[model samples]
Target: MGPITVTDDLARIDLDVVHRWLSTDAYWALGRSRETVEAAARGSLSFGALVRSDDGDELVGYARVVTDRATFAWLCDVYVAPSARGRGVGSALVRAVLEALEPMGLSRVMLATHDAHALYRRHGFGEPAHPEWLMALQPTPAASPATPAV
Candidate 1:
């Protein structure tokens, strides 16, 4: 495999590959729509990991961060192509992301992962210091319909 280069250039991202990976393979984003993916990319700080070869550059990984660029950031949508797994592409992409955000001196950066805990821990991520202080509100799909008058 060629050396993987990670960059924050949104123009370097291959959205088709990203959408396929997220919508079909990523458990957290299964069935996510293309329009949503496009809008997310447009609204976030997007990164791409590219492999440079004689054939040119091929995007093999992607990540995006939603941040105010000052106080907080949420890292999400991190994915690496199957072909690039075990080759450190994910690590490279994440390292690049952290480096890019270093200047902001944000108070916190957060991410949710099902199986990448070890990978993230190696980069300073850990269980929340105050789990009781954190909470989430995930609206159920069934709750969207209008209810009858009580």
Candidate 2:
């Protein structure tokens, strides 16, 4: 594997690969649609980790942050390709993201992960300081336009 290069260039992303990885492999995004993925990328700050080979640069990892670029950010959809795991690509990606956001001096950055707690802890991510104060609502999926509501 070649040296990994992390960049925030959205043009460098291969949406097909990202959708495949998330929709098929990622637990949090299983069955997610390409249109949804595209929309998420469009609305978030995106990063891609690439490696150059004779075949040219290939995107091996991705992450996105939803933020107002001021006081709050939510880091989500972080993924590293199977071929790219165990080689520090994930760390590099997260480091680049935090570095890019440091200037904003955001009050908080947050993410939720079923696994990778240790990895995130290495980058200063911890359980919420006030979990009791937080609440979430996950609404049921809306009916499709073709489906009549009961």
Candidate 3:
């Protein structure tokens, strides 16, 4: 809510804070490591941003944009720490990613958010008009087991 710092440089991020945030954020599947985020940030040809909270030097949220820089972009891995919700952190992260990609000449950009529809909408994202036009092939399922230990 107060002044927060947002940066495009992942190299300057404190990965330990990010690792802790991902570990506790329910909207994000647990299992991310600082190494993975660092790798993606280094390897991604598109855009990414790490959001940090002003209060405690914590990494509160993150998002990445995957794009071809031609006609399309897909935003993914939107995460906001539970302690960091309701503070515009999520929306701020999304907006920063979108702004980064605006110059890429993309005809359309998209992402899927289950319960945060309003947050994305506030950033000019809308539901896909053709539900029939969208389908995803996971390529490979997430390595996590289908059934959790019980």
Candidate 4:
């Protein structure tokens, strides 16, 4: 994880890299337009992980929280670039987001994951006690502009 840094500064995020990952590599948000992504970024609390190299710091991981910053937060769009994986980038990004939210007085933070349950589990996220009450207004696949992949 050498020289990797996590920050909540939206200005520090590299939109091109983030848009590329979400639009192509990431299972979620595939084929999402750059404009849509930029809009989403502006509406969310953004976190980015960067790896410092001779070329300077490159954005390698990202996560965002959609919240009113009062009572609830939904963590989404967590992704790490392929070249930056296996170096704890994902962990760093998640932890950073959590830390940033610590002072917001939020009562709950939620996220949905298909296969990375273990990663989130280590961060204190667990199965909801009232799973039966959880519901979504998810649009049909064709109707939705964004979809969750892996």
TM-score of each prediction: 0.83, 0.84, 0.67, 0.83
- What is the overall TM-score of model 2 with all chains considered together? 0.84
lDDT of 3 by residue, 33-104 (tens): 778866665665322233435564556667766777777777776667676788877777876776677677
Model 4, span 1-150: residue lDDT tens: 467799889899998889999999777789999998899999998899998877888898999889998877888999988887778898998888878887786666778766566677666665433553221222222342233211
Task: Determine which window of 10 residues in candidate 2 has minimal summed lDDT.
Answer: 132-141
Model 4: residue 70 alpha-carbon error in angstroms: 0.5
Task: Sort every candidate by TM-score, greatest first.
Answer: 2, 1, 4, 3
In each prediction, how many residue pairs overlap at the backbone (N, C-alpha, C within less than 3 A)? 0, 0, 0, 2
Error of 3 at 100 (Å): 1.1
The collision pairs in model 2 are: none
> lDDT (CA) for every model shown?
0.79, 0.81, 0.59, 0.77
Q: Which scores greater on lDDT, model 1 or model 2?
A: 2
Candidate 2 residue lDDT tens string, 42-148: 99999999999898999999999999998777888999999989999999998998888878877667777767766776776654335432211111125332322
CA lDDT for candidate 1: 0.79
Residue 33 C-alpha lDDT in model 3: 74
- Quote the positional error of residue 135 for candidate 1 in Å: 11
Candidate 1 structure quality by residue, lDDT tens digits, 24-90: 9999899999999999999999999999977788999999999999777888999999988999998
Model 1: number of backbone collisions: 0
Write down the RMSD of all candidates, one decimal each: 11.2, 11.7, 10.6, 9.3
Per-residue lDDT, model 1, residue 14, is: 86
State the lDDT at 20 in candidate 4: 91
